[model samples]
Target chain A: MLSSNPIKKSLNWLGRQLFNQENPAAFFDPLVTPINPLWIRGFTPAQVQDIITETADTKTFVLKPSNRWSGFEAGQHVNLSVDIDGVRYTRTFSLSSTPARWAEDGTITLTIKRLPGGLVTNWMHDNLKAGTVLGLSKAFGDFLVPTSVEPLLFIAGGSGITPILSLLETLEKDHYRAPVALLYFVRTQADVIGAERLYALRQRWPAFNLQVVHSQEDSKPVYLGEQHLDTIPGIKARLCYLCGPKGLMDLASDLLGKYGISDDRIRVTFFSAPAPVFTGESGGLVTFSRSGKEVEADDGKALLELAETAKLNPKYGCRMGICHQCKCTKTSGTVVNSLTGKVSSPGEEQIQLCISVPQGPVTIEL
Target chain B: MIKLTNEQLDALAKDLDAIRDEALADLGERDAKYIRKILRLHRTLEVGGRVMMPFGFIPPVFVAAVASLGLAKILENMEIGHNVMHGQYDWMNDPALNSQTYEWDTVCTSDSWRRTHNYEHHTYTNIIGKDRDYGYAVLRLSDDQKWHPAHSLQFINYILLTVFFQWGVGLHELETEKLRSREIRLRDKLPLIKEFFQKGGRQAFKDYVFFPLLTLPVAPIVLLGNAGANLIRNLWASTVIFCGHFTEQAETFTEEECEGESKGHWYLRQISGSSNFTGGLWVHILSGHLSHQIEHHVFPDIPAHRYREMAPKVQAICEKYGITYNTGSFGRQYMTVLRKIAHYSLPDRVRLKLQAA
Candidate 1:
């Protein structure tokens, strides 16, 4: 029976107030001790439970998030906010663990591939360890399996297999009785992330086919060509999900198009953009009006990255321009939208700082 | 004195921007340590004050306890609460210091304060019809504000506002002006009114009823002590806040002047509309670093201690631009603010004539 007694409710409120349970961490955080994860609210606090080295430059961080974190879908992404040297940085990554794992163990995994000179990724790989606490935004993303039971083809390269691994695990848990094949491309056998798990899945499920393509092992530069599509039965009928480096994904897309597959049958998630080319007009001055801070901003980097480099902590959510938390006033000068390749006029306007690059001398109210 | 051209203004803005950027870059262990230390001191003072309150049989002890408690409340509201709510220490990633989540030890709710203070006041500082903080919908502070007969007794209104400043802040989110003009329906204000009463009730209960009831043998002394402490805190907050933005040199703007405003112009307004007071480290913290009002206005999200460091740089830019940097000792600034409030109480034509005289 529901307790609708006013006396009980009043006592509960009194208890919360007395204990500061609404935000218990605020009372204890002044001691500089580790905050109990259960007390964290608003931004879900997660403790690093373990770090599994997947490859030489790749790691899967197992996180135990507080109760405030709602479970995520099998193929969704979450924004991880970490503080390094007193500066907080937020980066979005796919949750590589299945929802079932989260339900059973109350934990999630983020498989991160360290890029050369990458700030957050390198910091996590080197500095993050068990017992370190970080902030996490609730899971959000549209990339997921269709409701219809169509035959699946997942083409992944490098670290792009993280989300697919989650989908495969979910499929296995559900006992999905559909033909599914994964074409995972890596530099060599040692570079294959989650190879053992894929092999085990292939042995357990008859309909599941795992292909680990070693690009460097083949002298002729192994690439996804039309010849690879012929190997898959009913290639045109399969729903192809592509996630990888631009080169491999583009090749696979072209091959899929020639096979007369409908555009609706193809789904692609871009892990990273190719390195931006710096032209003569790339470098410019960015003025943060409020802070009285200005920096010489070079092209090829987003304004959010520049702001971080300048040590101006701006609020951000999904760094991919989906969450508009980093939107600030662009008071003067022009900036190019990195996502849309559009130039903003010099005037007062709101621009998403995450995806904006200064075209010339720019002034923003950060 | 020379008038600044748009180009000159932009340059001044850039110079000021450089200082802020440098300070932000310089923020590290020391700045974090400073805030944490202040927080610890505030907590210690509060606990000490509360514990000593029941021993009011001794007059000196009672006075000291009240003073300690008042100072603690002042520090919590100004240096810690206000600045943290401004996202000054958000980089620390400490939930306690988060601008979006930190609830102050005042009657006002943090969410309401964020909307009214952080968003409205910071965005539209000293703009006549825009910034509700222009006399906080009570007394007139500028000639742009049309005078009403009720303002004739603005001296009394000012005193009332000071005494009940926390309650006034609690009710600020309701935007009583909009309700008065019928721009906001009574129904729309219901939720805010409810929130105000709930928060106000909790505060009143804690200070007047709960704590006093606990000290049943000396309930009257406890109640009076709490009231006295609250009164002291409110008065100090009101004075510090008023001196910052309602001084003789603080300028108010029109909506037209603010239209399509550039970053440089925004900075210009913030500096011109904020007055500062000369003070030591303790005085600055007690004032919630509002003694560096110009710097605080310019970089609302920068930690308060950084404002003290940035003040001279900011003042130099003001001097270079031939702009008046309104600053004086606390007594002088507070008196000037009161005089300005009184000057605006009369009709605009009368005030203009007085100004000319």
Candidate 2:
């Protein structure tokens, strides 16, 4: 505590020297301070969990503690939160495995079926080995299953079977045994998920009818592969839920709208995102239908660029499959097979033209 | 991918050659007027018969006059003369004219300049990716463009100049780039010093460099005259370009929009995007009539001279399709663009809120 002025001065000089050495010109900006982590509102898979495969490409990931006790009434969904790289991201999956699973094991099960580039599903495939601890949020979504006793019709395309499967499970468990019709579309015999479980479900319940529409080169006429939906009978009284891509949903909308059904009665879940963009070789011409202009797009290019060349204001958003905001209706003609020689057939109704190419000529309702 | 069809290719080649021939014809006419004058001066300067003068005024007198007129005034006069000329290819149509190679070495024409000047330079002004006109972002020669590393200091210089001289910075920067262009050489350059009655920069450089340098002299008299001419011209032009682009009307391309291959949307974007300054002929020509930015962006191959004729056609097309055509008088749109620039360049949150509607 005595006066050691020179020593103190020497220490101060050293401190200044150190500071200057660390920062030249004292111009270093540490940038704004990062905010605290957001306790995310999306759903999470239970940490003490296991994915028991109910069928091929289908598994029930049991989340412990049921995240939320009662926000969902059956058809609602919980957005699964996952840490993608360093950034936390979330994806919504319908609660298809039923709330009853929570009674036995304090777990809410998500019957996830694999789809292309599905972030959470792909992440689960890669990292979710058994007994891995994870975080989850309580259920948070507004889509609720109807409690009405009307004939419930579910028209599912490919992996669109998830929510319907959950609804059926809930109906059977709750003793709501209402008459139901399901027309499930699959690419091949191998594409059907939860088929065995569904087969048992049909055998136990006489009121449930199941139709499998397959897309294959050779199939029986009575089998009626991927034929028109208008041929399906007794749709007048059924309360319908359509789930698939925008094209599939449009078909559902148009066909069902014909029967004088109000749009509110039909709940549609277009596949999580839009379809894959048609990739191609370099340099093909793009003819803007109404603009009287032709612009060039090279291979692996999106058709939206052609509008830029012609000076058109096309409405848009994330061109990636995420937003699905740029979905345009393809009026007629085929889009060039960006990869193989097959055009994107989104049903007979529409195509997300952003992901489609020009074949011969094409017109769009821009 | 952008290859021309065989017939179009042949037409393009022939057109290129014809343009060359036309430029030569114009040069031939200029040589006829200036060739004898140069010869007479050379002869007079050599021996005592007559006092030979290569230029109308001595180098010092010319410099003094230019200094009084100032760099801004000289630029204004040049800009006016250039505007009046307006890609003048009258010489090409003239039967009496010969090509520059055969006829003259002194004079140049607008048609020839179009290849080097308009086609290559102006068409690519300040484009960041392919074109090299990456001028400073601050006191811009063009509009808000992608920043260039080389221009950082130059932009600082521009602002400092402006702080003292108002638009002195802009005029100097533009004229300097214009004068020192590659088109000048020693043969054309050496005589300018004698014209200005000074000796450092030869005439072609003087025309290219020193003639423009006349705009930047330090003297008060020179600076004053330069101010009057440039302020008017700069205001006229800056108003035109800034209004056409900087307005609330114009929008930046999203990554989706930028990369989309759809020509219709691009057309719609340009149609909906750019603002047009409407009305008047004198202001139009002086401002380079760029309010038709949408048309120019859509069909860059078309000449500026043809734009006036094409404006209505373009407008009609937009109208038929129910496309919104944005047009406003000079002052109205110019302030709009200024406000837009200020608004957009703010923090992202502010810009996002403003743009969401």
Candidate 3:
């Protein structure tokens, strides 16, 4: 999007192509930007495991659909592109793996529940299997584990744990000796995705505490108010990391502020695309000098998001980057990473931008 | 020109529901009878070693076909929903068409939608103040008229806002418009309120909240397949719709012009509003029948199935009446529309944020 005229032209051309052909790969033109455009060729159902007991309708599928070699970020998703009869279609999904996880294995574990009137996801539950090849695109998001940020707090709800799981993996890799806490909310005990894993992680590292709160469950009535996550405890101090449905994240955020958590301490990842924040130029050159990416981020998205949308392939994690995969050395001017968070370092030439809002011609090193 | 009255609207709603039911029932009967032949064909294919997959998922070769089916189903729903909802309102004179039956079906008809979608949206487009889809400070679609200080000289702010908050803005605009409309009494609109409350009320409050929340976040497979089917059909049909309106060469009249135009001028305006795509095959299957946006804009009441036979006639009449007749290749026109929408957003990409102080 930063590179307007050409990107717009390309998108226009691709949009036209999509009109003619269902799930056209033309729309997934990676050459449009330096980023690796997520290409969904096809997929095979990998594993189906039950997550929650709500009708057991929600099952997580470890998909290895035909054709596609999954390339994803922890919080990014794949668009299931399928064609039925003669019509073609595409749907977006948030990936549950970090790039490292995806690079090693071409498997995307999609935590799916039967949607009431959903199109592709509904078909996935009813018909998909090991050999069932569904259309899939490569990793198309910037959400992943932030690298080595202090006192990281991960707050999640329901099946929203997929991205957080990837973050947990990255945190383990960086081996940061900071206190990392996870507050996962679900309807019941069964809804917690990696409760045992986190428990083990908690046991291994006293700095890491795993707390699971179920709003609907009578037995473990932790975090009683289903309406507001702000009602939780110890939300301040820690650099908050959030991945779940929007409402939960919003509630977490609203509560964080209420409990005296500054906007600087909190980060949220929406289940769908979050609103656009100015990442500097409304339409101009965006140079991530260290990453060798100098392009126009004109399409009206966050510079990071534009980078992702145009497939810039920049290194970013936890899109909120409380983890700091989106951390960059701000060699020149300032960049707004988040709509609210700001970290000013005039001398060191570095900043974390999932919270750094963009202004003008800015340079960053990965 | 028939004046649109509330009684007429109610009557129209009833009639549209009846048309939908009758058409759906007829289509169902036809499908049942035709399905035997289709089954026979499938059986023949099966015997001949053709690959026939199950209802839900299938192999790769069929992926495109499956997507197409999904697109088709979606289009059929939209077409049936939209066309039966509006296009048939003029057919109240036909005694064969029944209204009482369809008025009460689930997926209640949106009178508000009729106002926004039928009356204003398509008619007003992106003319900011006039079109209720006005997005404030943060930019939404280029057509949203407001210019906030943050967006002045900061198009990325505008674009990001548009892409991210586009859906919300759309939904909000409808809700905002409906809320402000003063037409629907608060008590009578309670059913809708109740429906939304029942559907959207306790999203995380009630355990059932997961049902609708999961509708998108956790989309159900069966419903998705059906919706996929519906979406496929809709895509195919929507292609025609998007192409028809959003195509290139369609003049986007300014708010002053659009609002100021006379009824005759408005009639001519809608004529010049959209374009017709080319190719005899396209003319035959898509342009010829399934949709006639070009003709519909000129004479919205005329049935689309009658477009192919009537298009030349309509064009000739426009020529005689000194009204411009717009037509082009579908691909060409659609590309034009995209370019225009994109173009419209670029003019003030960087609005000056300060005075020369």
DockQ of 3: 0.02
All candidates: interface RMSD: 7.3, 30.3, 24.8
TM-score to true structure, per model: 0.68, 0.33, 0.36
lDDT of each: 0.81, 0.47, 0.47
- Model 2 clash tally, residue pairs: 55
The CA lDDT at A282 in model 1 is 52
The CAPRI-style docking tier of model 3 reads: incorrect
Regions of model 3 farther than 4 Å from truth:
A1-55, A65-70, A78-91, A114-123, A127-142, A194-207, A219-237, A245-247, A258-260, A272-366, B1-357
**Per-residue lDDT of model 2, residues A1-366, tens digit only:** 566888777655543332211221111111110121121112223553677775467667766643434445566676565543322334567776666656556666677766575555767765666555444545655444666787777878766777777778777766666677788877777877778767888888777888877755256422222354554466777778887556567777777788777888898764553333433333445666676677765555556655655687775443432122344545444464332234542211233344556644445555
Name the regions of candidate 1 deviating beyond 4 angstroms. A1-39, A66-77, A85-87, A97-108, A116-118, A137-154, A166-181, A196-209, A232-242, A246-366, B1-11, B24-72, B84-158, B169-225, B245-273, B318-357
Model 3, B31-74: lDDT tens per residue? 22322233233223222211212323444534543454433333
A best-first ranking of the candidates according to their lDDT comes to 1, 3, 2
Clashes of each: 4, 55, 97
DockQ of each candidate relative to the true complex: 0.14, 0.01, 0.02
How high is the DockQ of candidate 2?
0.01
Q: How does model 3 score by TM-score?
A: 0.36
Rank candidates by DockQ, best first. Answer: 1, 3, 2
Candidate 2, CAPRI quality class derived from DockQ: incorrect
Candidate 1: RMSD to truth: 9.1
Better of 1 and 3 by lDDT: 1
